[model samples]
Target: MTFSLLARCPETGRFGMVISSSSPAVAARCAHARAGVGVAASQNITDPALGPALLDALARGRSAPEAMAEVTAIAPHIQYRQLLCVDAAGRTAHWSGERILGTWGVAEGDGAVAGGNLLAHDGVPAAMVAGFAAARGDLGDRLVAALRAGRDAGGEAGPVHSAGLLMVDAASWPVASLRCDWLDQGCPIEAVARAWDVYAPQMAAYVQRAMDPREAPSYGVPGDE
Candidate 1:
C-alpha cells in the first residue's frame, strides 16, 4: 500500500525521501532522515523506529548495506517490513521481507533506491528510479519527479490518499518537510508537488532566518514593512 524512495544528493550532500500510500499519514511513520547521516523509509507493516535506527547506524559510520543488515536482524517481526536506505556516501540498500504485500518491487539508481508494496505493477519502482535520474533541479525536485513517475507507471493497487516529501541539508532539522496527510478526492502526489513548487523558492530564506536573522531577508508581508 506504499511506495517510497530514499536518496542522497551527491552534488549537495543532502538526504531526502518521497513516499505515498493508500494509508493516511504514511510518512508520519515511514519517512526518516538526518542532516549528515542518511535517509530511510520503513513501510509494509510500518515500524517507525526502524527509520531512526537505520540513520543512527549510518551516523555511526556503517555503510548502507551494513546498517540495513544490522537493523533487519535485530528488528522484531522483520518478515513483513519493507525498508530502503541511502547513506551519506550515496551507498544504497533495500530489504523486502518474504511476506511483503502484493506485487512489490525494488530498484536502485545512481544515488537512490525505491521500493513499493501492493503496487499496481512491479515496474513502478524502476520507473521512479528512472524518473529521479532524468529529473533536474534540487534533490527535492528530483524526488517529486520520481513520485510522479511512480504514479504514471501505476502506483498503488488502489488510489493513494496520503503523500510526503522530506529532505535534510546541513541543518540539524529537515530543510523541506511537506505532506498531504489525507486527500479525500485528489491525488496526493500532485498535491505534494504543488506544495514543493511554492516552498522551494523560499527554502533558503527560511534557513537564513533560522541561522542568522540579521542577514536574513525580510518577511515581505505587510506587517514587516
Candidate 2:
C-alpha cells in the first residue's frame, strides 16, 4: 500500500523523503527526519512512534542498521510493519516484515534506499533507486525523478491517493514539506511534484524571510506591496 525512499545528499548533507500511498495523509504517519540526524519511514501497519524512536537511536551515535534493529526489536507488532532508515553518514538499512503485502522489495544506492509493498511489480523499488542515482540536479529534483520512475514501473496494487515530500537542511525546521492528500482527481505524485516546482525556487527566500524579513523579497502579500 505504500512506496517510499529515504535519501541523503552526500554533497550537501541534506536528508529527504518522497512517499506515496493508498492511505490518506500517509506522510504524516510514515515519514520522519532531522537536520543532522537521519531519516526514517515506517509503513504497512505503521507505528508512527517507531520513526522518532529510530531517529533517537541514530542521534545517540548508532548507525542506521543498529538503530533500526534496536527500534524494530522493541516494536510490539514488528511483523506487520516495514521500516527504513538512513543516517547522517549516508548508511542505509531497511526491513520488510514477513507480513508485508504482495510483491514487496527494497533497493539501495550510493546514499539512498527505496522500498515498497503491494506494488504492481517487484522491479519498482530498483527502478526508483536507479532513477535517483541517475538524475542530475538538486536532491529535490532527483527525488521527484525517482518517484516518477516508480509510478512508471507500475505503482501500488491500486491507485495511490496521497503523496508527500519532506526535506530538512541545516535549519531546525524543514526547508520543504509538501503533501497531496486524498487526491481524487489528479495523480498525487504529480501534484507533489508540481508543488515542489513552485516551492523550490522560493525555498531560500522563505528561510530569508524567517531570518531577516527586511531583506526577504516581497511577493505582494497583503501589506508587502
Candidate 3:
C-alpha cells in the first residue's frame, strides 16, 4: 500500500518527491534523479538499477517517454512496476504494468507526476496530479501539498507506516534528503508534511548561509559569538 508524488516547482525550478509505503527507505530505492537531467520514481515493483541509468539517458537529451520506454523495454516483464518520469525540460511519462494490482499512477501539471499501487482507487493518481497543479510556491510547498491531496483522496489501501521526502539540485550535495520512518497510526503523510514545514525554513537559511556566508544572521542567542 502506497501513495507517492514527484514534482518540480514552477517558481523555483527545484525538483522533489514525496513517497510513503510499507517499504523501507522508499526514497533511496524507488526514487532517482540528476540535477540537470530528470527525476523518476519506480515503485510497487522497483528495480534499483534502472533509476540511475535512466537519468543518464535523459541527461543526454532523451525525452521523458523515450527514456521510460527504453528502460521498460530492456525488461519487458515489468509487471508490478509503476513508474513516473519527468525530464529536466518538464516533460513527463508514466506506465503501470497490467499485473500491478491496485496500482494507479498519473503524470500531470507543469512538472509533476504522482503514482501508487495498492491504493484505495484510481482517483488517487488523478487527485495527486490535480493537487500538484493547484499547488503554489517552491518545490517544498508543492511536494507537501501534493501529498496532502493524495491522502485526502484515499491514500494507499489501508494504513501508512512511513513517509519520505527527497529533493536534489545541481550541486555536490543534494538539496534535501528528509524523511519520517514508521510514523504513528493510519497515515504518516500528514506528519511528514509537518516535518517539512518545520525543516524548510531552517534548511533554507542554512542553504542561504552556505551560498552567502555574510547572510548568516548572527543571532544573539547567548554566547553565540
Candidate 4:
C-alpha cells in the first residue's frame, strides 16, 4: 500500500524521507528521521513506534542491522511489519516479514534505501533507489525525483491518494515537512513537489527570520509598513 525512501545527504548531513501510499496520511506513520542520527521507515502493517525505536537505537550507537534486530525482537506482531533503516555511517538494513502485503520488496543506494508493499510490481523499490542515485541537486530534489520515479514505474496496485516529503538539517526542527493529504484532480507526488518549489527558496529566509530578524530578508510580500 506504500512506497517510500529514506536518505541522508552527504553534503549537508541531513536526513529525510519521501513516501506515498493508497492509504491516507501514510507518511505520518511510515517515514521517520532524526538529525545527526539516521532514518527508519516502518510500513506493511506499520508499528509507528518502530520508527522511533529504530532511531533511538541508532542514537545509542547501533548499526542499522543491529537496530533492526533489536527493534524487531521486542516489537509486537513482527510478522506483519516491514522496516528499512539507514544509519549515519550509510549502512542499511531491512526486513519484510512473512505476512506483508502483495509484491513487497526493498532496495538500497548510496546513503539511501527504498521499500514498498502492495506494489504494482516488485521493481518499484529498486527504481526509487536508482532515481535517487541518478538525480541531481539537493537531497530534497533527489528524494522527490525518486518518488516520481516510483510513481512512473508503476506505483501501488491501487490509486495513490496521499504523499509526503520530510527533511531535517542541523536544526532541531524540520527543514521541510510537506504533505498532500488528499488528491482529487492531481497526483499527490506532484502536489508535494509543487509545495517544495514554493517552500525551498524561502526556507533560508524563514530560518534567518527566526534567528535574527534584523538580518533576515524581506518577506517579499506587501504591507510591511
Pairs that collide in candidate 3 are 102-118
Alpha-carbon shift of residue 42 in model 2 (angstroms): 0.3
TM-score of 1: 0.99
Model 1 Cα shift for residue 89 (angstroms): 0.7
Q: What lDDT would each prediction earn against the true structure?
A: 0.95, 0.92, 0.76, 0.91
Candidate 1: the clashing residue pairs are none
Q: Which stretches of candidate 2 lie above 4 Å from their native place?
A: none
Which tens-of-lDDT digit does each residue in 1-225 have in candidate 4?
A: 999998888888989999999888888888888888988999998899999999999999999999999998999899999999889998888988999999988998888889999999999999999999999998899999999999999999999999999998877778889999888667999999999999988988888887788999987879863
- Please identify which of the two predictions, 2 or 4, would achieve the higher TM-score against the true structure: 2
Q: lDDT by residue for model 3 over 59-118, one digit each (tens)?
A: 878999898888888765687677888887788888788878664656577677788888
User: At residue 159, what lDDT does model 2 achieve?
Assistant: 94
Give per-residue CA lDDT, model 2, range 1-225, as digits (tens): 999889999999999999999999999999999999999999998889988998999999999999988987888889998999999999999988899978898999888999999999888999999889889998999999999989888988899999999999998889999999888877999999999999999999998888888898986578767
Please give the RMSD of candidate 4 to the true structure: 1.2
- Model 4 regions more than 4 Å off: none
Q: Per-prediction TM-score, please?
A: 0.99, 0.97, 0.88, 0.96
Instruction: Write the residue-wise lDDT of candidate 1 on 1-225 in tens digits.
Output: 999988999989999999999999998999999998999999998999999999999999999999999999999989999999999889999999999999999999998999999999999999999999999999999999999999999999999999999999999999999999999999999999999999999999999999999999988789994
Please give the lDDT score at residue 130 for candidate 1: 96
Pairs clashing in candidate 4? 1-117
Model 3 lDDT, full chain set? 0.76
Ranking by TM-score: 1, 2, 4, 3
